[model samples]
Each structure stands twice: as C-alpha cells, then as structure tokens.
Target: MSRTLNLGILAHVDAGKTSLTERLLHTAGVIDELGSVDAGNTQTDSLALERQRGITIKSAVASFVVDDVVVNLIDTPGHPDFIAEVERVLDVLDGAVLVVSAVEGVQAQTRVLMRTLRRLEIPTVVFVNKMDRRGADGQRVARDVVEKLETDAPIYFGSAITGVGVDDLVAGVTSSLPSIDPVDGPLAGTVFKVERGRAGEKVALVRLFSGTVRVRDRVKIGDSAGKVTAIAVFEGGAAPRRATARAGQIAKLWGLDVRIGDTIGVAHRDRVRHFAPPTLETVVESHDRVALHAALEQLAEQDPLINLRLDGDDIVVSLYGEVQKEVLETTLALEYGVAVTFRETRTVRVERPQGVGEAVRFIGENPYAATIGLRVEPGPAVFRLEVELGSLPRAFFTATEEAVRGTLRADRVHDCTVTMTHSGYSSPVSVAGDFRGLAPIVLREALRRAGTATCEPMHRFRLEIPADVLTAVLAALSKVGGVPLTTTATVLEGFVPAARVHELRRRLPSLTRGEGVLESEFDHYA
Candidate 1:
C-alpha cells in the first residue's frame, strides 16, 4: 500500500493560487516546463474561460510524490462567487495550503476560507506568496492572518513566482501535516465533483474513505447502482488509468450518474455545510429555448447544488454574486454554443411555516389517484418527515420515506426548502402507485394552511475601519438594516440581511478610503 496525503490550495482571487500550483508541480518534476497563469498556459486551468479571465472557475486536481508519499493536490477557485466549488471539495482534504499575497495582505475571501478550514478542523499551513513584489511585507500579512482569521497557523514566507520558499513550503507540508488513516468501514465515499467525459458518459470524482474499489466493482450512489467500467487516478497533472483505488484516495469512477454531495457506499455523510445560501436569482433567456434548457440540464448535472428549475417557459438559476452570473453566461456560449440572456437579478425568497396545520386528499380528488394525509408544523430541521408505521405496510415504508425526503426540498408555499416538524401520512391500505405524486399536493395544502411567510437569509459581519471613519461606517450599517452586536474603537460587529451584503462590500471601501475591512458569514434567516 502507498502512503497518501490529500491537500487543497486555497486563496483569494489573483493571490497566486494557480501560480503556486504551477510552481509546485514544476519543482516536483511532475511537469517538464513551467506554465504561467498570465500566459493562460497553466496545467490545471484547462478551461477556455479560465484562460480568458485568468481566474479559476472550477476546482482541478493534480498529484505528485513527496518523501515516498503520493500527494493529491486540489487547487480551488479563489473567487467568493465560486466558494461553493471549494466547499464541496473540502470533504476530501486532510490538510490545506492557504496562500496569502504578501502584497495584498489578508482579504475577505481569505478570512472566509480560514473560518471554514478551522470549522472543519483541517490543519493548514499558511504561505505568504509574492514576497518579491514591492511593498510586500510577509510579517505584516502573517500578523493580519492571525488577527483577522483568529488562527495560530504556522506561516511560511515565500513567492510562488520566484521559487524563494517553494522547497521550504513542500517540506513543511510533508513534515508538519500528519497523515489521516482511512476510516474503518464498508466501501463508503462522497461524490464531491462530477463531469461529463468526451463520450458523454457520466464521470464522478469520489473520495473513498474505506474499502478498495476496483474496475467492474458494483457501487451504489444514493439509490442508484452501477458497475464501474473504468477508474482514473490523479497523478502528475493527469488522471492516469488505475485498476483499483482504496480508502483515503480520490478517484474518478465511470458508469454511475452520481451527483455532487451524493454518498457512494453504505453510510452517508451530510453535504458539506456552506455559510451562505444563494441570495440572487436570474431568469435565463435564449433564442433557442429547447437547446438552452438542455444545456442547463447538463450544467445542473455537474453542480447539483445550483438547484436549476424550469418555470413554464422560463428557467431560473440561483447565483452567489455577479461573477457567477458572468461565468454562466460565458460558459453557455463558449462550451455549449448556446447564446443566452438573463433578466435582472431578484432576491430569492424562502418560505417558513407560521403555525400548525393539516390537509388530506383522497382518491378521485381532482386528478389524484392516491390518498395522502399530511400534518405540517414549523420546527428545526429543514424538512422532517415522520410516518406512523402501524398505518402503512412495512414493505412500502422504504419507498415512501425516500419520496418524502425527496419532496422535502421544495414545498408549494414558496418553492423553497421549508423547515417543518413533520409531514406524514397514515393509511391502512397501500396505494397502487407511488405516493410521491400525491404527496406534493397534500404537502402544499398543509403548508398553505400553516401560514407561510417569505423569509430571506441573513449574515453576520465584522468591519474594521479607521477610528475616525467609525461614525460613517455605523451610518452605512444602519442604512443596510444592520444591528450592531459589538462596537469598538476601530471594529464593528453586527448582523445584516444577506441581500445587503453586496452593498456593504461595495460601499465600505469607498467610505473608508480603501482602508475598511469587511468579513461576513451566514447567520440565519429573517
């Protein structure tokens, strides 16, 4: 067996994350020549849009050997808009290399990634890149990291471009970070990423935690089952053919239509938690509606969390910020050759149940062919389902439970995933067909009677500014309906609606003459 380590490279936009990846691979002799992000020739950034924009729109993986250990390196997008891509990849990482630009110091996205790394308890080594640039102060940046990120991370000063501290950074990774033993269990893995092969066959990038997976092995992803026809292991900037992949390794498996966050194997792990939900939504318009819909369906298969839905003649998409919107537009035209337009972004509305209520629909009602009795009430879980086992046959319980959980994501009230105490049915007779069809109507009525209200997600923010600018910052926060939780000479902590995050982020820099620092994370919904 080979010793292995899985790690990720994370940072803010243009902070030299891809640069660091290129330099590391070159130094390890994994690649023959160095590739530069500015020249659009980096090995990991193979996408055309990435080259055009000089930003990583998707996460890419590469592998190299260090000190007899096969190290799998995941380079993640640095933009806040694509943070979801980073969140999904977090499950596979044993540790991470957080790159901070010595010239720019600690940034908002840097702070966000640090908070997540800490929350996940993934050990990290901070690398201060771009030290050769004028005004680059590795010491000041290290101090900022400790102060803003609140982490006692071991910091290494170096420039990924100049190879000043590249060797030291590699040594730190191999020596300082301990290896993670594979969890003992059956063949269980999480599908963190997915893509389509050249032949249009579905390929799932899975992080296997236990058991050995070989070609032709039968694997189960959620309720779907398929036999793996091929396997690819990330090595030396390429995914080469592999016969088998064991626990603690990341591999690509074919023949399974697995979505991101799907559990492949016995026990299931919850989807990686994200601090903020998408607050912006846009309607997709295209001259060729049919082709555009098909294109979106394909995109949805790649990133299931986007939750792309079709509404009659229109298709609506959830967005993190403006960058995502631009990327989607460019990708559609570039990848699928589908020219599309988008409507002005609108705030995505979520629904919450106000009180308790129940609804019943029997056979021969409207177009229904089954009976469903559901009682819905507000509670903690996103959508909890309970059934009276005595009322239904044991054989049908499994199917019914799956259907209920599937429908929980979308309720009729506001088309949002609603939190509820319970939505259940009791029947002495088993329905002829699946209850999934009837459950939606019953659930919708129950939620309607429960008194649904539109709710928006909220965020808690911290702003650091000059002492003299504190009063102006307070006024700006007040204008955005922010409630301050704490106020000091130069810092203000408060909670505000997520809808106003972009405004605060945009205005603060101008208000404080580019000296203000703002950090925000999801708090709750209001």
Candidate 2:
C-alpha cells in the first residue's frame, strides 16, 4: 500500500511562502514553471483581490509524490486577515512547514501561528526563505526564531526563487516529518473544504483516515447524510474526476451538504474552536435586500463563523474585525455583485441557559406533522438526544437536532445542552423538513421556560511587562474591563471581554512604556 503525508505550508505575510509552494510543485514536476505572485499566476492564491494584492487569502491544495509516499501540500493564507481560513485548514494537516523570512525574521503573526502549532502538537519543520536576497541574515534570523517561537526543530535556509536549499527542505520533510501508515478501520474522514461547484452542488474536500468511499455511496456526514455522487482523488492526474477515494488520501467529493470542520464518515477528530468566536456585529444594507440576503446565505454557508442573520429590518453579520469586514464587502461586490454599506459595529452579547426546563408537543396537536419535545438546561454537550436513537428516522433526528443547534447558535448562546425529551411523527404525513422546521419553535419555548443569563464573552489574556511598570500595566488593564487573575513577577494573566482584547493590545504599549507584550485567546463567558 502506498503511504501518504498531508503537509501544510504556513507563514506570515511576504515570507515567500507562496513562492516556496510554487517551487516545490515545479520541482516535483507537478507544474511546468514557477507561478509568480506578482504576475498573478500563482496556483494557490486564486482570488481576484488576492492576486491583485500579491497575497494569499484562501487555502489551496495540490499533491506531489516523493519516493513511495504521496505528499498532499496545503498552501494556507499568510495574511492575518485570512486567519480564519488558515485556522480552518490547520486540523487537516499531519505536519506543517513554518516559513520564516531571513530578512524580516519572526513576525507577530508568525509567533501566533507557532504558538498554535505547538499547542496542537503538530510536527513542524521551520524553513527560512529568501536566503538569496540581500540583507538576509540566516544565523540571526534563526536565533530570533528560537527566541521568539521557542521551537527546537531544525531550520532549513533556502531561497525559494533560486531553488537553492529547497531540495534539502524536501528531504527533511520526507524524513523528519511523519508519514502515517494508513490503517484499516471504520470509515473516518474529515471535511476540510467545502466549495460550490459550477452546477451549485457542494464539493467536499475530504482527508480520509481509513476505509474507502466510492462513487454513489450513501455516507453519513456528521449530522447530515448524502450520496457520494462523484469522487476525484488528489493522488493522480492533473485532476482525477472520478475515482474511489481510499484511506490516507485526499479527494474532492460531490453530492454532500457538508461544512468545513465536519466529519465526513465516522468522527475522525473533534474540531476544537480555539480562536475567539466572532462577537462584533454590523448591519448590511443594500438596494435589493432579497438578492443581498441570498448572496449572504451562500457566503455564510462557506464560513459558518460569519453568523449572518436577519435582525428585524436590518441584516446583521458577525465578524472579527475591520479587515474581515473589508474582505466581506469585497467578496460581496466581486462575487455576488451586491453593493452594500455597513452600519455601526456593536458587541454581540451571548446567553447561557440559567435553569432546566422541558416542553413537549404531540404530533396531532402540533401544526407540523412532527412532534418534538425539548429540554433546555445548562451543560457541556451542545445537543444531546435523551430519547431512544431509533425512535424516528435518522434523517428526521438529524434534521431536528441540527435545527436545534442552528437556532441556539443564531441566538448566540453558550454551554447549553438541548436534549430531545420526546419525538414522534405521523407515518405518511411526516417528513424530515417538518421536524427541522418545528425544532426551533420547540427549542425556543423550552429556552424561555428555562430562562437565560446574558454574558459578555471573554478572552484569556497574558501580558508581559517590565517589573517596574507592572503597577501601571495593571491599572491600564482595569480600564478595559480586564480581570487580572494572577501575577508572576512581571507577567500578568487574566480574562478580559473578547471585544476589548484588541483595545487592550492597543493600549499595552503606552501603559508599559512600549515594553509590554500581550497575547489573548477566547476563554469563556462571564
């Protein structure tokens, strides 16, 4: 059996990471020539604005063979603005190549990425690119990388443009990095990317850990089920249009309504959301509200974090910050052709169930042909089925539970497990759509009975400052709703409102006389 390695190449902006990707592909005979970012001809940076800006925005995939193993190369965006896209792809990688610039050394985003990689324990190989350019200091840059990122891995210095030291890098990846031997087991695959085909069908880019998925196979995709109408394995041909996607392979599968971070077969791995969820919201208005809404629906399907919704007369979009806002506007105008304007941004408060409550609706009594009994209470599991699993058709159960979670997510609630207290359906009259449509109503009724406590989502923050300025830093943190939990010498740690983290980061420099360093990530709600 052939082995495979799902490798990711990640870096901060302008580190020649994309150039390194093009070089790797060309060296492996995957492409005829190196595609230039400046020429707008790179293989991975496909977006129009991405090409214009000479930076990657979307994660791209290509396969290359080395010895007996097939290496699946994932080119992720280097920009902080597209960190969501990058974050979505990180879990799919078996190993990663962290690209650092020889001249610029380790950057802010580079440190962030390095921390995440270390936290995840993803085996990483650091590559120092642009060694051929003037002002490039490989030794000093290597020291900086060690000092900043604190990684003990070997760093390869190479000029991506000149193809020098790249062969060594490839050798390091093949030898030092892990290549998993595919094992036999129940079908377990992860959906890493979801794209709309030309015919508007969802195309799932899946990384299969075990078992095989062939054409026309009915598969369970997390909470949903669908037939695999077509398959294109990434191992062979310029594009393998139809083939069986087997274990240890990546493939483009059609005929599935799935999302990124979804398990395609059995649960391969639980996708942990580490980044702070978007709580900043703004209103979008257009001349054609219907068209604008339709476009946003499509966009939101691709990125669930957007949290697009109807807020009375306005359409609200939840996002991270200004850069994401600009990207959304650009995507709307360029792809959907819907010109729009945004209203004042505001903090979106989240809620948690304060008490336990149950509500039940019978089949004949309910307007819909499905009966759903829901119990809302404070817990960890987001959605749990208390009743027998086979009480209803799997499709109906999936739909109802999916709807329950959707409604809760739309309402911006945290840490509440909704249980299916009871479920019933009319034999001939009932359908999955009926249960899906009724679920939200029953869930909301139970939530109302339980009541809730609105909370401001917070971030776990760590600040390093000079010992002399600790007092001043502590005072500054208090101004931004920061709760300092602990102090170790000059290091302060605590939780702050997620929305105000950026504000604290902005104020840290002034508070500590430019000697303050702060790092924060979403922690919990208070």
Candidate 3:
C-alpha cells in the first residue's frame, strides 16, 4: 500500500502560500484549471473573504496524488495574526513546504514560523516561489533560509506561476521526504489542531506518531484523560468506512475533548507532549453581540490555536502575531456572517521590578526549606532560565520547577525575555514565578512594557526597480525607521540593500510603496 504524507505550505503573508497551493494542485492534476489567490478562485482558499482580501485567513486542506503517494496539503495563513492557525495546523503536519518569495527572502513572520517549526521538529523544504516575478532570485532566498533562519533545508526552485520548478519540488517532496518514526514503546500522537464539526461535535485531526489504531479503539487524550470511542478515517469531505489507522496517517477521530496543545493516543496514558499555545488574545468587535460569539467560535473551530474564551463580558481569542487582527476582522465579516471590528490586540508582556530582593518560601513538614536571594534584571529575549538542583531530591526539584512554571504561565511571563542566574543559595527554597503579565497596547509602548525588548527583524532586501526610483527608495527607508546598514548600487541595474533592526512594522511597506520588495529575519535585538 502507498503511504500518505501530510504537509503544510507556510510563509509570510503574500509570500505565495495560496498561490503555491494552487500550483501544486494543478501539478497533481487535482484541478483542471488553475486559480489565482488574487482572483480568489483557488481550491484551498474558497472562502469569500479569502478571495476578496487575496490572502488566506485560515488553514485549508486539500489532497492530491503525486508519485503514487497521497499528499494531504494544508495551506495555512501567512499573516502573523493568524499565527495561531499556523501553530494549530503544524501539529498535524509531518512536513512543510516553506514558501519564501524570491524577491523577499526570509521575513519577520517567517522567522517566528521557522522557530515554531524547529520547536516541533517538523522536517521542511524551502520553495522559492514567484521566481518569474521581476528581481526574483531563488539562490538568494535559499541562502537566507540556511543562514538567517538556521534551517538546514534544501531549496527546490519553483515558480508557482509558470511551473518553472514545480516538477522538481514535487519530486523532492515525494522522494526526499523524511519519515517520522513512532515512539519507542507506546502509541503516541499529538493533538495539534482541534475544531467543532457539524452539529457541535468536536473533531480532532491527529498525526499518529506510532503504533496502530482500530475502529472502536479507546484512547485517552491529555491530562484530562478524554477518551475517543470511535475512530473514523477522513475521506475528502465525508467520513471513511475504514476502521483502523496507523502511524504517519492523519485521522479524524471523534470523542476527543481536545485543546490545541493536548496530546492523544494509546499506551502513553500518563504522558502528553504539550505543543506551544498562543500568547496573545483579543476580542472580536461586532455590531451583533450574539453573532460575535458564534463567529469567533466558528473561527476558533477552524483554528484551535486560537483559544477562544468568555471572561465575563469579554470574548477573547488567542493570537500569534499582530497582522492577525486584520485577518480576524476580514474572516469574521466574510466567513462567519458578521461584520466585525477588532480592538487593538494587546500583546502579552512580562515585568520584573529592578533591584527587588524577593524570596519564595517552600516549606513542607519534611523540614526542607530552600531559600535563594535574587535580584531581577532583563536577559536575552529567547532563552529561559532553568535550574537543576543536584543536591535536592528529584521530587522536590520537580515540584519546585512545576510551581515556577505554573506561576510563570499564569502570570504570562513567557511573553517577555527572561534570564535567571544563580544568586546566593540558602536553606529555604526561594523558587517562585516572577515578572508576570505585561502589556503593550500600542506602538511605541516600551519594550519593557511589551515584555519584549525590541528585537528587530533583519533582512537582506533585494530590490529590482527602475534606477530612477533609487533616490526615492533610499529616502523612504528613513521615514520607516529603517537604517541602511548596507547598500550596493549598480547603474541602471537598481540596488540591493541589507538592513537590520529590532522591529519593522508599517514602515517596510510604506517605504517600499508595496512595489519595492523586501524580506527579513529576526536578527538579535541589540
């Protein structure tokens, strides 16, 4: 029997994720006629808002056969706001086709997405799409993928427009794809994404990591020990007759009361691998109060990474990036039958008072009190502090770590950069979560307030424009807070400028006139 591979097409918004989906479908002969994302006729992005906005708002799945292997393709939204959608979909994918624009190599959102993929350990291939577009360079993009994104991914050249490199990409996907081996001793699969199906039934799209599953098989999910009584295969839009599924197979199973990070499977009854959850949440503003909840719920159903919650009068949905706010508005108005407005998304941040000596008291009847004196200060943005006590008992250390992590999560400290160093240690354990729940309500909000000290996305922007536009282009950078870190000019040939920053928002597009191209990575924040 031929094996099936589940893959996702991921990129920054307008990086041709949907366009690549259209081309891949066409190449696989799933569609007789090709549809354009701009025109909104693509099979994956059939939603009306997707067509009108010419961008993918939710992750859409479509399947095709290539090299006798069934490839289940998930086209995910590239905008940061919909990052929750990407995060949820990545749970189901065994591999990904990371589409980077030839003119714009690795971008800000791309860097964040790549980090998430690495965390998940999902194998990936880089596709440099829009190669036929003016100034397109596949080699440059491939270099950016390796250097900036730190991905050892090989580039498969392809123009989704003219089918220039589509065949090679398809071949690489089929032949070079890596296999995800099942866990050593148990049946393990992760609940990457969850959605509400027809008539309020919850459907979980699970990627089994190992072992076999049969019809009527009983499986436990997450710590809640939610069980699934029925295992059903997904056949296009309908349920399949098959009663069993195996490792590497994507199955739609019912009876799983799953959240985005939950893991579900047999054998691994007590242990669950929790995927990263969304860090930001926002309310959906709509004129119809009743419809707002339903629309947000439907959107949440489509993308579980968007954790939707009703906190009293507020309807909150988790988000991954800022651009998602706009996408949410568009998706609500288009797909959910509600015209909506969005409150400016509040970014979760972390705050720690400087020079404050704080102590956490851990006292048990066992007469074990561990206290450590500490001072709080900012650390690097990405690394977290982890303490392993060799002298302490394993259970004590575990309990302390759990307590700290719990405090941090409840306090939303993960939203900011944290560094923990050893201060002097005493008998009483002073291990408690610190620096919780910061906020950045608008631009220019202090990086400290945002719980994120500014870390600018760096890009080696390759622009191919008329030579006459060079002066206007260079000047536009200053207006957008971009410093021309490096510029190489050639007469009549245009310019290739490389810029570095801690952040780029609204300025990159404004400087480029939506015509000049750019791509960037998260270079370390200075």
Candidate 4:
C-alpha cells in the first residue's frame, strides 16, 4: 500500500529552520534550485515581505516523492508570534521533525512548541541540525534535549548543508513514523492553512487523512458542508494543477469558501479535529489611516489566528508571539504600504464566577430577553463542555449548542466550554459559555460572578557554565526576571559545581559569556 506522510519542520526562530527546509527540498529533488533564508530566496518564504525580512511569516506546503513515497512537508513559522500558525498546522500533521541548532541547543520558543506537541501526543523526531557551523556540538545538544525537553527523543545528527547523516535521518523517519488511522472511513481531510489568490479568491491547503479525492470531485467542508468545485495540486510557488490526491496527501483545493482549520471530506466532516489557534492579539500601525482596515482584513483572511478588530482608533490584531507581531509589522509596511504599530501583547484570560448565582435577565432595545442562570465556579483547566441531549429532540440540542458557541465567539470568549443539556425536556438547555465583556457584568449582577487567572506559560531553564562563573550567571539571571528554583553541584575532579535543572535564566548568558550551555523547559505557571 502506498503511504503519505504529513510532517512539519519546527524549531526556534533563526535556528535555520527555513535553511533546513530548502536543503530538504533540494535533496529530495523537489526543486531544481535551493533558496537561502539569509538571501531571502527560499521557496517557502516567497512573499515580498518574507524575502525582505529573511524569515517565514506563515506556513508553506510543498510535496515531493522520495523512493516512491510521497512526503508532504509543512514548513511552519519558528517565531512565537506565528505560534498560532504552528498550533493550527500541528493538528493535521501525523508527525513532526523538530530541528535544533547544535550551537544554540534549545531556546524559549522550542520549549513552548515541545510542550504543545506533547499535549497533542504527536510522535516526533529531533533533528540536531547545523553541525557544519563552528562550535556545533550535536552530542551535547542531544543530551540537552533529553534533560531539558524531558523526552527520550531519538536524535539524528545531520548537516543540512553537507547532507551528512541526511540519509540516515530519512530512513529513521520513514521507518518510525506512525500511519494515519482514520476513524471516519475513506477520504477525510483538514485545512491546515489558507491564502488569498492574487485574483482575490481563497485557496485552501488540505491534508487528506484517509480515502481518496480527485480533481472535480465534489467535497464538503466543516459543519457548513460547503462544496469544493475544483482540486489543485501545489508544488510550492506555482499555480496549482488539476490532480487527484489520496489519503495522507496534501493538496491545494480551490472553489470553496473554506476557512483555515476546517475539515473536508465525504461523510468525514464530523470526525475532523481542530487544533487550538493563536491566542495573542495586536493592532496594525499605518502611516495612512485609510489603508489600515483594508490591510488588516487582507491579513486576517490569510491567517485567521490574527483576529483583527477596530478597537477605537487603533487597528487591533491578535498574534501568538512577538516574532509573529514583528512579521505583521513588516508585512504591513512592505505588502500593504502601511506603517503599522502594535501594543504590548496580552495573554488570553478566562474568567468565571467564584460562587453560585441565580438567573440574570437583560432586556435589550428589542423585545427579546437574554436570560442566563449560570453558576460560575472554577472547573478543571482543560475539560470539554460536552452537550448531552436526553429527552429533547436531538436537533434542538445541536442547534442550541451551536447558538451558544456562536454567542461565545461573537462575545470574544473563543476559549470557553459550552454544552447543551436535555434530560426530560429541559427547554433545549444551553450550558457554559465563558463570556467576557461588559454584557457579562449585567448578567453577573443579576446572577452570580467569580474569577481566577492562569498566566500564559513559564519555562524551567538549566545552564551549564564554567564553575568559576556560576555566581555571575546566577546574578545575571536575577536581572532578567529569572526565578531560582533549585541548584546542584557536580562532584567532578576540577570543575565548578554543575547546576541540574532549576536556576535563574538571566545568569546563563553572562555566566557562559559564549562558553557555558543553558537549557530550559515549560515549567508550571507561577
């Protein structure tokens, strides 16, 4: 049986992720030429802004056949601001290749990505890349992966430039990666990314998990069941061709109003899973106010994670991390002819009432009444609010739940649980919708209210510096807001005390002074 592998190239920003992607495509013979990230000539970073900035602003897909096996490579943005792009792509991938710079080992964003991968339970292979660079210690970096990432990730040391160990790495991936086991029989797929055609239409890049789809094959997407009129094959930086794609293959499908994170298939729409989109939000800065909305709208269509809004005078756009924010600014200036400015990023906060509350009713200008009797209290941080229809018609439960979720989204509480309950005719009941905003206050005053806060993400950093510079390192960490969790001493013959996992972060750069090694993981929130 022929198999298709959906793999992602992930790493920290400037870890040579785009460079490695170019090399892989060139080696695989997918491209006749190789593009350099520094030169801004890479196939994936084809946008004008990307070429000028020398970084990947969005996820790009390209396919190649190696040894009769078709490999679909998704090159994702390594910067944190584009993390929403990363998170959205991860859901459709069967596996990922985590590229780590041998010289830098692991950085802050790497820890965040690894934690996300673990949470998704995706199998991964770690690529210790850039062995060609001076001071590139693959073995030491491999050890750091084990200790800091807390993974037994089998390492494949290689140089993307020289192709050394590339073959071995390929063999390991082909042999160990898991095959897709689709629950919704035959030909279901999910849209990982989307972009607008130069002519102003939407183009969806989809990954098929099972079954087969051919050009001109009618397909439905998401709960809306929108039909796809055409299928286009994409080979990077070119117009798509009419083609048929099977399970595990990535194809560019046209003629559908499909959004990113939408699932496409024949009877497989219900089984498709959506990944968590980007959380950070920001606003666009432009020299001219007239072009700001148009630019922001175009960007939002390209990547849905960047939730765009007009919050008074500022044009607001949400981002996953700082890197994404920078890319947005660059793109606005270069692509849209707008000089964009951004506010400091704020974490997406969730609020719920602390105690029990009664039903609150609000009468708007219309005759309709908005009544909600919610008992707001803290539940598990990550539990799905499942809707259960008991005696009410199943259709009613589904409709009501959809309405509740829609309300939540419109109210700007995209990350909340809501369920429909119908045990012995409960009037088509709709449960939790963690609504935010002032309207919730009117509801809370009439009912009940409570609140709890969970910060974005924290990491545990470990630095291995010369024994003589330990104190200086520790002191530096204090300056950068590093909290010292723990310290340990290594009993070597002549070396200074080696710290284990816990310590301050600011100290590492000063302690190492270009000599010591530092590592960290996603530690729990404060």
Top lDDT: which candidate number? 2
Q: Lowest-lDDT window of 10 residues in candidate 4?
A: 490-499
What is each predicted model's overall lDDT from 0 to 1? 0.81, 0.86, 0.61, 0.63
Tens digit per residue, CA lDDT, model 4, 426-509? 233332232222234433342233343433434455556667776666556555556665664411111121122233333345
TM-score of model 3 vs. true structure: 0.63
TM-score of each: 0.91, 0.84, 0.63, 0.74
What is the C-alpha lDDT profile of model 2 across 254-335, one tens digit per residue?
8888878888779877789755577688999999999999999988777877878876788999877787788888889998
Candidate 1 per-residue lDDT over residues 207-269, each given as its tens digit = 887888889999887878889999998765578889987888889999887778888887645
Preferred candidate (lDDT higher): 1 or 3: 1
Q: Tell me, by TM-score, which candidate is best.
A: 1
- Candidates ranked, most accurate by TM-score first: 1, 2, 4, 3
Instruction: Give the clashing residue pairs of candidate 1, or none.
Output: none
Q: Show pairs that collide, candidate 2.
A: none
* By lDDT: ranked, best first: 2, 1, 4, 3
